[model samples]
Target: MPANRAFVLNSRPSRETPAGPHNFRYVESDIGEPGDGQVLVRHHYLSLDPYMRGRMNDAKSYAQPQPLGEVMVGGTVGEVVASRNPRFAVGDHVVGSGGWQLYSLSDGRGLRKIEGGTPMQAWLGPVGMPGVTAWYGVNKIIAPQAGETVVVSAATGAVGSVVGQLAKLAGAKAVGIAGGAAKCEFAVKELGYDICVDHSDADFGDRLKAALPDGINGIFENVGGKPFEQAMLWLNPFARIALCGLVASGYDGTPTPLPDVRVLLNTRSRMEGFIVSDHMALWPQALGELAGHVAAGRIRWRETVAQGLEAAPQAFFAMLKGGNFGKQLVKLVE
Candidate 1:
């Protein structure tokens, strides 16, 4: 029997402190065989996302807190190495919540088989949760019309990149807000954004206003601090805002209060906060459209891959701090 190497939650992180190595402990345990109706998956890639930071806390959230002495929860794309279930077979690739481990044992629940049309890692990224999140936000919450201006923060990231591209496909001007100069350039040149603003710049607000002469018709809010505040100043009448994430204060306890939330009221704008899992009914339709776009080369994506299972912890924190570009993943297998 082979040993399974995994990272377990050693302790819960405080709201004030960022999660680190102290929060987790690596464990090597003997792999056990499946009983009946079970499958063993060897993880090829593990996704590192910002939402994991909120799960580290012991506070009440939409989801349960990550349990201590258990494997850290994450998205994984892997192949079935062993199967005792009729639903799953050996050599079948799958995507599921397999946590931060080299392998996962499951009873075939919550596992979706991969059909090999897209790259394996893409299933964990652009064609997966992140892509679906953007789809739901753009298609449902901040529904944009032609000739409108749509903006997305964290523009070079997994969800934000899709939001910008989808807005463009809707015939709206896609304006992206990213952290550094390089990211801003990539958002415009590589991702086909109309204008890319550098939120890290000293005159960020000035540049943001200058870029939008027609005001913002819709916004996909990923970072909530300065970017959200600045976007408020340009809200068009009856504009819509999709509150996707707040990576700005996910680690720290403080959530920067909007300079004036009345902006929503003032412009009669709508701001909706959504969790993609809550809308499972929309997924098949969403993934179908996204897969088509990706397959046809209309929707492009990028990845920041960390090497080995051990790098998962480091990569997770780095991604939360905007140290990574696009979707961050750890390659657990060659």
Candidate 2:
């Protein structure tokens, strides 16, 4: 048996944000060989996402609270070092919910084998959950028509970036709202957005309104605060909003004050919140399409990778505050 290092939730956050490093306790324990029907995997990359913040709370929500003293939940891309199951073999690469650990033991449930054509890290970002989330929200929910305008907040983020790109692929004008000037530049120059507004600017609302003179027909709402409220002001008739995330308020668990619903009623606009997991039926289709886009280089993605497993907490905290660009990940192995 070899020692496996893991991060466990030691205390609940008093607020919506992570309680700090003191709340996560690192422990090393002996990992036995895989039992019959199980596989032992060595994690290479650990995903850091905003949604994990909500799971730390004791409050009621779509998913249950993360139990105290248990390994923190997260997505991981790893290699099977040993396998007792016929379905998986040594040296196989897999994607699964492997938690915050150096290694994991699984029975192949919810595990998907990944091909080697693309970077393994891509399996956690563009061609994985975030990409599928964007695909479903854009193609299925918003369904923007050509020449329409679609606005997305957190535009440089994993999901938001893909949302903008997908909108452009559909011949729609994609507008982005991001935190700083650099991200705004990347959104327009690299992601092919028509325009990107810097939320940090004092005149952000004015800028957003100017960019979409034709009004917004669809919205991929990622940050649900004033940016969302501002987007509401420019809704075209029959506008659709795919409420993918609320990273703005997720950290503090604060209630987001919404704009008046009278506008929505007058415009007959639609706004719906979605959990990607709830739409399991669409995963295969979404992932397949996303994979093709990524493989052909039609989709460009960036990563802010922390070097080691020990760096996961800081990397995760920075991601919550918009400190990282693109997808946030922890590279656990060389």
Candidate 3:
């Protein structure tokens, strides 16, 4: 049998010392057989998300930390090369938490069989967790109304892109806050955002406020820091904030302080922080909604892919630094 190449976590990363390639060790092992009730998957794509950084630490979190001396945890879409499981068959495409490996052996628990309505890679992106995340945050938390103003940070990313489109679909003015001019332009021109502000600019706060003459009724906060803090200054009465991610804090573990304490009380704003997996029952509904939007061309998504499994570590590090444009993924197979 051909060797199964994988990256195993060798050490834990901390707030003071961030993780790097040194924390992982590459190994080659035999591609073992899958016995009865098991399936062998050959991963085609692996998702690189910000949450994986949190899993690298051994501290208490909403979920268990990634165990050391094992394959690093991640989402993957692949083909079942071998299956003794009755639910799965050879040549079947699947999506699951398959980790950072060329191949994986599974008992077919969380693995979802791909039905081919949408593109396969999208199961890791727009029609998948990111899409469901956007749908839930916008509809359940942010709850934008017609003609209201909604804002999303990291506007061109997988989740943020979908967030903006969904807000627009709700008849709200979608405002995007992204890193550079190029992304800002894409948010407005392609994603149908009303106005997209460049957060990297020196006068970003002023520009953001200027773009929102009506103030913010809803916010899908992906990157919380100075950008989110600036956006907070213009919260409208009874505005809603869906706290999806704090990209900066997730990496280094330093909290970004938003000092405008009185706004929540003054505006009666509601801020809800969520983990998408917690609401398992809502996923089917949310995914169906998202897939329909995608089918109708109401939702647009993008991806940035790295070449191979060996490049997963560096790609992940780059993605954390905002080097990626949309959904950061590694193409594990040709």
Candidate 4:
């Protein structure tokens, strides 16, 4: 039997921001065989996300803290090599909360068997959590009308990219805000956004204003801080803002200060924050539409894959720093 490689949370960060390699320690262990109702899964891909940063802390949050000495929590798509459970068979593909490890044993709770023409990795990306997240924010929250303008921060990321495309599908003009010139180009050219403003530019506010001349009717906000503050300046009357994430404050585990409430009051705008899991009733509808768009080549996605289980720690840190483009995942096995 081969040993299972797992990245465990060895130490908690002393500060709120900047998670470093010292926080995680990789270890090899013998997981043995699955129990009577369990399945042995070998991870093929692990999803790295901004939310995991919050889990690393001991502070209270929507989700429980990641336990020290346990495998770092994450979503994984993998193959069932052995199964004692009747629900899952050997060689079946599954997506679940498998954590950061080469192998995991599951009793089938929260595990979903996936089989499709789409690549398995897509189950962890655009057609998975990120896609559904974008759908909920755009369709349920923002609800932009045709000919309206919608601005999305972190435009090149998994969620933001999908938000832009969904806005276009709704007949709205999509404007994106990204950190660099290359990412801005990708958002506009590849993702079909009407315009993309580089947040790192000296005149980013001016550029965003120019791109949205009619004022922003909707905003799918992912990155907060200065970018979010700038977007608030262009809100039209009765505008909608879906607050998805604050990646700017994610690293430090700091609370993102709310932008001036006066703007919301003056514009009669609606801004709401959401957790995608809270809307589980809509998953089937969201996934079906996202899958259709992906299969028909209507929705475009990109990935920054790091090979092997050992690479999970560095990959996670890199993702937090915005080093990866699009969806960031760790390829645990071939």
Candidate 5:
């Protein structure tokens, strides 16, 4: 039997990204066969996100942090190559927390079977984790209504793009804030956001105010930094903020402190931070509805795929720096 080649995090990363010995190691090791109640998966695509940055540190969080020298954690779409479980069979298409590796051994917990006949990459984007993040945050959390105004940071990302569209479907005016003009343009033209503001603009705060004359009813808060601080001033009474990933603060060398909580209190609004892991039971319902929207031409998505496992680390860092156009995925194999 051939061994699986895996990308394992070598050490705790610094803000500038630890280089050489401080970063990652690729090693060839035995790909263990499935034991009873387990399945052997050949990973096809891996989803990369800023949240994984937190997992690298030895700190407490919503989930157990990844230990040093373990396979770096991530989500992947894989084919069941060998199964020791009655619930799965050979060639089954499933999604799991398979990490940055060519193969994974799972005991069937936290595994989701993908159907709907859509392209597999869609599962890594709109029909998968990112999509669910967008849907539940907007519909269930934010609860935007017709005539309301919804704003989203990281507007061109997998979750933000879906967030903007789902807001529109609920009859609200959707506004997007992205890094540059090109991304802002895509948010407006491709994603159907009512207004897309460029966060990189010199007068971005002023521009956002101009685009949204009315106060915002809901905010899909993904990137938490300057943009989040600025958006805070524009929220209306009873505004709901679905605080997802803090991509901006997560990458900074020094920790970034949030603005005053008095602002949230003054506006009579609520901000809730969540991990999708907590909402696992709602995922099937979310994915089913999101895929139906995609099939019906209501929600759409895009992806930037790096061709191989070797490119995973680079692609991940690029995504952190706002280099990816849409959902960032690494093609691990096949």
Candidate 6:
């Protein structure tokens, strides 16, 4: 059998994902032959997101949870090494749900042939799901107006970074709330947010309140623990909050405490939570616009690439802990 390496989730993660050697097992397996209309591809880049942590459990959600003893669910960009489908040929680059493995076989389902105008890894980051999520959150959910103050937590991450920049492009004053000085600097300096507050600062709440004295018109929420609680105080009447992910409590078994609804009622504001899957029908238009922005140099992105497939599990856990600088991509092979 031709051998291939894969990252397998041994068990559901608790508060923190245990090391790969403990919670994840790497093993060599047969490189199963491609069936009719299928292609055998070798992975180059794998996109890691916090939502994957929620999928690790068997619990029901918007999408089917990853089943135990199965290869972990992820999006990958790969080059076709063998093809049985006429639509794809050997040496073609494709992006699809290829999982975390050195080799993947796909039957053309949900696969897109990629071009070389930009880096192939981009299909897994900006101009992909993360970028699509930001577009949906801003245009459909928040709808920030010119002069409105828009804030995004986890601001330097793939999704949040796009959210903030899109808000700026729409003429809204964007403020990002990130984890530390470095992330905050990136958000303000590189991504070009109006201001960025570090959530780790002892006076973070005060700083946020001071930054938005007239109140926030829209908030693209990514981190939902203390930041969500504090953002509530600054929301303008009829303000909209686009709740994306709750990375702060996603990995744990403990129930995430719901934020007080009284604030919503008292301020007459709206808070709506969403996943990208809910807006699938709009993906083509959204991705087209995002791709245009990326190609036009309007949207800036940064990626931290890990060296190999063996690095995915460790890189994923590190990302969950806010250790990654930007979009984390694991390179499976050359």
**Number of clashes recorded per candidate:** 0, 1, 0, 2, 0, 0
lDDT of 6 by residue, 154-196 (tens): 9999999999999999999999999999899999989999899
Query: Which structure is stronger by TM-score: 3 or 6?
Result: 3
Which whole-number lDDT from 0 to 100 does residue 71 have in model 1? 95
Query: How high a TM-score does candidate 4 get?
Result: 0.97
Candidate closest to the true structure, highest lDDT: 2
**TM-score of every model versus the real structure:** 0.98, 0.98, 0.98, 0.97, 0.95, 0.96
lDDT of 1: 0.91
For candidate 4, the per-residue lDDT at 116 reads 70
Name model 6 segments beyond 4 Å from true: 14-21
lDDT of 5 at 67: 74
User: Comparing candidate 4 with candidate 6, which one achieves the higher lDDT?
Assistant: 4
Report the error of model 1 at residue 282, Å.
1.1
Residue 281 error for model 6, in Å? 1.1
Candidate 5 deviant stretches above 4 angstroms:
14-21, 251-253
Which pairs clash in model 4?
16-252, 17-252
Alpha-carbon RMSD, candidate 3: 1.1
Candidate 5 residue-wise lDDT, 1-334, digit = tens: 4589888877776646643334777788999779999999999999998888767765667777677677988989989999999999999999888999999999999887888478877888899889988988987789999999999999989899999999999999999999998999899999999999999999999998998798889989998899988888888999999999888876444576778878788999998888787887898899889999999899877889999998988888888889999999998765
Candidate 5 — which pairs collide? none
Q: State the lDDT of candidate 1 residue by residue for 212-253, as single tens digits.
A: 999999999998988989988999999999998999864455
Candidate 4 residue spans exceeding 4 A from truth: 16-18
Global lDDT scores for all candidate models: 0.91, 0.92, 0.90, 0.91, 0.87, 0.87
| Local error of candidate 3 at residue 29 (angstroms) | 1.2
